[model samples]
Target: MSLVRSAGLQKFRQSVEALGGDPEVYARRAGLPVDALDSDELLVEDSALAAVLEIAAADLGCPDLGLRVGRAQDFGMLGPLAVAIQHSPSVADALACTSRYMFVHARDLSVALVEDPDGSHGVVGLRYSFSAGKRPLPQATDMTMLFLHRAVEFLVGGRYGLRSVDLPHQPAAPRSRYEDAFGARVRFGRDAALLRVPSSLLSRPLDGVDETLRRLALAFLSQQSSEARPLVTAKVRTVLDQSLGTGSTELVDVARALAVHPRTLQRQLAAEGESFASVLDSVRRARARTYLTTTDMPLSQVSDLIGFAEQGVLSRCAQRWWGRTPSALRQEARSRARPRA
Candidate 1:
C-alpha cells in the first residue's frame, strides 16, 4: 500500500466527496487502512486507488471528474508561478523559466517552447513520464492536465485555449471532459500525447510580477529533482516512426508502454531541452522532405502516411518548416532530380 500524508489524502477525499462519491466507500474499496482513512494520514494501494477513482468517475458518467478535483487543488499551487513567468521580458524566457520552476513538485511533468520560422511560438507541450514502479494513475495524470489547462487559462485571462490535445489511449472515454476542459481539438490513439497552442498567444505580456510570490514558487521548485527523461528527441522519433502506419498514437499509451510515469518522462525531455511535440514536428518535417523527393505518393496520402490529421495541417506545417508548399517542394525536388537532357 502506498501511504501519503493525511493532509494530502484528506484533500483527495474531499475532492471525491465533492464529486458526489462516498469517500468512505472509496477509501474502503481502495484498500485504505480503515483507521488510516480516518486519521490525518492515509495508506492505500496505488492500483486500488486508481481503480476506485476510475469506477467513481465511470459511475458519474464523467471520466474527467477527477480532473476537476485535481485542477482545484493543484492550479492554486501553480498560478503564481505561471504569473511570474508570464511577466518575464519575453515569452521565450518566460517558458524557459517556467519549465525550471514548474518541475520542482511536479517532477514527472515538463514544459517546453516551440518556435516556427515565422516567429510563432507554441508552448511546445506538456506530458508526464513515469519511472519504473511509479506508473501514474490515469486519474492523477488527467488531474494534472486539468490543473495545467486551467493555469494557462488563468495566465491568459481566458483569451484562448489549447490548440489541440493528444491522448495516448483509444479515447473510448473522457471525450466530453477533455472537450470541456481544453475546448480544443482532441486526438487519441497517438504515440505521444500533446497539447498545442497558437504561437501568437505567447507574446501577450503578463499583468505584473510579484517578487515575493515568485520567490516562494521558485523555492518550491528548487527543492525537488529527479533523473528521468520523457521528452527525449530520440524517444519521440521512435514513437513517431512506430505510429507512421498506425495513424494514431496516444501519449499516455506511450508512457505506459515505456514503463515510466508520464510526468517523469516529460521532465526528462524538458531537461534535455526538447518536447514531444517539437520532436514530432521535426519528424514530420523530415518525413515530408523524404517522401517528396523519394516517393511518388500523392500529397494527401503522404500526409496521412505521416500521421497528419489532414492534408491542410500538413501543408501549413510544411510551409512553416520549409517556407514552401508541398507541391512546390515536390516540384523543386523533381527539378533537382532531373539529369542533363
Candidate 2:
C-alpha cells in the first residue's frame, strides 16, 4: 500500500552476502526478484520489504539483522532526504528535515521530534509511527532507531547521545543484546517507539555546514513536495489496520475518519493506482502473515484480530498470501527460529 525505497533490501543483500549466503535465494523465498539489485532507483512495496527483511533474518539465523544493517549505514543512502539534512546547521534542523521530507524517501513510516513534557531535564526525542499500524514494519523498528542515532552523529560526533529508548514490541533476544547495541537502557511494550536525548544537544552544529547545497536541496524538495500526492492510500491503510476487529473496515468509515468523502478518497486512490478494498486486503494480509509467523496465537484469534468472519475465511486468505496454510507458516517460522546444534 506504500512505496519503500529499496535501500533496506540492498543493505540486507550486503549483510547476507557477508555471511556467505546467497541473498537472492533468501529474497526469492520472500516473493521478491533477485534483480532487485539491478536498480537502486527501483522502489519496492512496503509489505514486501518487511517480508524480505523478516525472512532474511530468519534464514541467516541473525536475530539482530535490523540492528546490524542500521549500524552499517551512513546518511548517503537516504536519498534526497540525506542531502537536505547533511547541510543543516543543527540537529534540530536535521530532525525537521526528516519530519517534513521523509515521505520522499519512505512511505507509510513517519519520523518526528518531540519534547518530553514529563521530564525535569531537557529531554527531547524522536518518535516513529507507521501509517499502516505496527504490523507494517515488524522488523524495521530497530533499524530506524539505529539510523536516527547514526545520522545525527554523522554530523555532531559525540557519545551518540541518548538518554533512553522504548519499543512497542517484545524483545526477540536478551536485554543485553539491545542495551549493548544501543548503548542505552532499553524497555519494551512501550506505548510508542521513541529514542530520547537531551534537548540542549538539539542546537549542536554540524561539522561542515554547506550554505550553497542547503538552498539548492531546499528548492528541489519544495518542488517535489508540491507535486507529491498526499499519501491517501497510506492513511486508508492505517485507519483500516486500527479499525479491524473493532467494527468495520468499511470505506465510508475509513473516509470519515480521514475527514473526507468516501468517493473523494476513492478518487485519490485511483490516482495512486489503488482501491479501498485493495488497501484493506493489503493490510489484512500483512497483519495475517506477521501474526502467523511471529506469535503463537491460534488461527481463530488471528482471524478475529484481522476482522475475518471466521477461521475458514482466514484460511483462504492465508493460502493466498503465503501459498500455505496458517499452521504451515507458523511451523516454518518456528523451524527457522530454532538454533542449530
Candidate 3:
C-alpha cells in the first residue's frame, strides 16, 4: 500500500484558488475531505487523489492544471523530506537520503540517480505508484515530476540544467505546459517518468546547506526509516538497499545489526516463506534493473553496487534473469523508455 504526500494535493487546491476556481466545490464534488490537503501529516490514497486531480482539472477547464500545481510547489511543500534533502552535502546525497527515507512520504515513490553510459549524462528518475503492479494517474504523474524539478531548483540555484522530461503517459495536458515549465524537451508515453540531468551536477555541493539542520533531519529520518514501517521483511529490504553499494548485503551482517541470531532471522523469514538469500537476490534484481535502465552506470560499477564481486558476475546474473547481457539490457531499456509517436 502506497500513500501520497498531502503537499501535492495542497498545491492543487492552491492552484485552483489562484486561478479563481472553487477548490471547495471540487473537493466536495470529488468525494474528498475539503481540508485534507491542509494537513501536513496526512497521507493520502494516490488513486483517490488522482481522481480528484482529474476531476478538478476538468471542472476548472484547465488543461495545464497539473503543470500549474507542480510549478508552484516548493521545498517546504515536501515537509520533513525537504529538510533532509536540502541539508544534505550534495545533490547525490540528497537523492540517496530520499531513496532511503521516501517511505514516509509515499509507500512506492522512488527517486534515484541514474548516470548515463560512458559518464556522459545522468538523470534522476522519479517513479511513484500508489498500488503494486499499477501505474498512477497521468495528472498525478505530471504534478510529481514537475514539483520535484521545482524542488531541485530550490535546492540549487538554477533549473538543475535538466536535459529532458520523460513521461510515461501521453499528454493529458498541453505539451507546451511541460516544455515551458521544464525549459527542456518533453517526451510523452515513454516507459517511465524521469528528469534527465548532467552527470556532473550530482556532486555539486548545495550552497548554504545547514549542517545542523542536516544532522537533525538525518536523526529524525533514522528513527522513522522504512525499517520501522511494516514488517521484518521491510527492514531487510531497507538494509539491503543501503548496504548494496558497499558490497556487504549478507544476512548475517543484517541480522547482527538487528541484534538477532542468524538462525532467528532466518526462521522469521522462513515463516513468511522467504529466505535471506532470496531476499538479497530480489533486492539485487530490483537495483540492477533500475541501474541498467535508468543510468549509464558502467557494468563494473553496477556489479559493485549490487554485491557482485565483478562485472562478469552481473553479466551472468543478467543473462539468467533477463536473458540479455548487461549492454543488451541497457539498450532494450533505453528503447522502451523512449517517447512514443
Candidate 4:
C-alpha cells in the first residue's frame, strides 16, 4: 500500500474532539490503528489517512474539517524536512528540496511548480496531486492545500505573493470557508489543486538561512531515504496504485515508468515471488476497501475509478475477495461508522 508519515494527521485528534466526535472511533472505521497519530515517525496507509479525514468530517458534522486541521498545523510537523526547507537560501530552492524529498513523507503524494497553467507570464502554480488510484477525497485535498499556503507564509512571512488557490472539486464547504482559510481568492472546480504565486517570489532569498544546518538536515534525510528504500514488490505496488485509474495498468506501461525492460521487470517480480497481475489486484483491493468504507460514491462510479469497465465486474471481484457484494460491504461499513450514544 502507498504509505505516508503520520505527520499528515498533525491536528487530527484535536479537530475531531473539538467537533465532538471520538477520534479513535473514526480512526478504527478508516482502518487506521488508534495510536496511528501518536508519533510522526509512524507510517500509515495514505488512503487510510485520507479516509480518516473524510470520515471525521462527515461524522462530526464539520464541513471544513480539513481546513480547520490544516490551519492548526505548520511546517514543524514535517520534522527534519522542515528544517532543511527553512535553511534553503531561496524559495525556489526550498520547493525543489520539497519535491525531491517529499517521498520521505508521503510516497503517493507529489508537489511541483508548473509554469503558466493558464498561459499567463510571471505566474507559477504549486500543484498537489496523489499518485494513488484516483483523485483524493475533498477533505484530503483541502487539508493539503491549506498546509501548502501556510508553509509558504512561514517561509517568507507576510509578504508571500499568494494570488489565489485552485481546487479540483467543487465546494464541499462554503466559498467563504476556503477564502478565509487561504486568505486569498479561492476558485473551485479546477483541473488541479494549485497555489498561484508570482514567479519572482521563487528567487527571493529567505531570511537567516543557515547553509550548514541545511546540509546536515539534507544528510539526515538522505540516510533515512536509503534505509527506507522499498523492495521491488513495494515499488510495483506504487506504480500499480497510480496506473489503475488510467487504464494503463498493463505490465509494459509500469515497466516503462520504472525504466526497466518488461522481461527484466517480470524477472524481478518473480524473484520477489510476485507477478504484475497480483500486485495490480492487491492495489485495486485496497482502493476498493477504502472507497467502500469512506465514501458515499455510487457503485458504478467506484467501479470506474478502480478501472473496472462495469459495475458487475466490481461486484464479482468484491464477492471473490471479501465474500460479499460491493453494496453489502458498503452497508456494513456505514453501519459500523455510526457513533454510539
Measured against the true structure, the TM-scores of the candidates, in listed sequence, are 0.49, 0.64, 0.62, 0.67
lDDT top scorer: 4
Best by TM-score: 4
- What does candidate 3's lDDT look like per residue over 160-254, in tens digits? 77777788899986788789988999898876677777766778999888989988888876776554443565567668878888746777899
Query: Candidate 4 overall Cα lDDT vs. reference?
Result: 0.84
Q: Could you tell me the lDDT of residue 255 within candidate 3?
A: 94
Q: Evaluate residue 59 in candidate 4 and report its C-alpha lDDT on the 0 to 100 scale.
A: 78
- The segments of candidate 1 whose C-alpha lies over 4 angstroms from its true place after superposition are 1-15, 31-52, 58-61, 78-94, 113-123, 132-137, 172-174, 223-341
lDDT of 3 at 232: 64
Q: Which residue pairs in candidate 3 have backbone atoms (N, alpha carbon, C) closer than 3 angstroms, thus clashing?
A: 115-296, 116-296, 117-296
Lowest lDDT sum, 10 consecutive residues, model 1, at: 1-10
RMSD of each: 24.9, 11.5, 20.5, 11.8
Tens digits of lDDT, candidate 2, 1-341: 56766675547767776865556556657755344543343356767777776887777787788787778776787776687798998888988887888776776678887766346477886788778445445467777777777776677775856888888878865778788878899888877788888888878887788878988888877765524544676688668868887868888888889999999999998876688888788778767766877688889999999988789999998788768999998897777567658
How far off is residue 312 in model 3, in Å?
Answer: 76
Q: What C-alpha lDDT values do all the predictions have?
A: 0.59, 0.75, 0.74, 0.84
Off by over 4 Å in 2: 117-120, 226-341
- Model 4, range 290-318, lDDT digits (tens) per residue? 78877899999899989999999999999
Shift of residue 107 alpha carbon in model 2, Å: 2.2
For model 2, what is the C-alpha lDDT against the true structure? 0.75
Ordering by TM-score: 4, 2, 3, 1
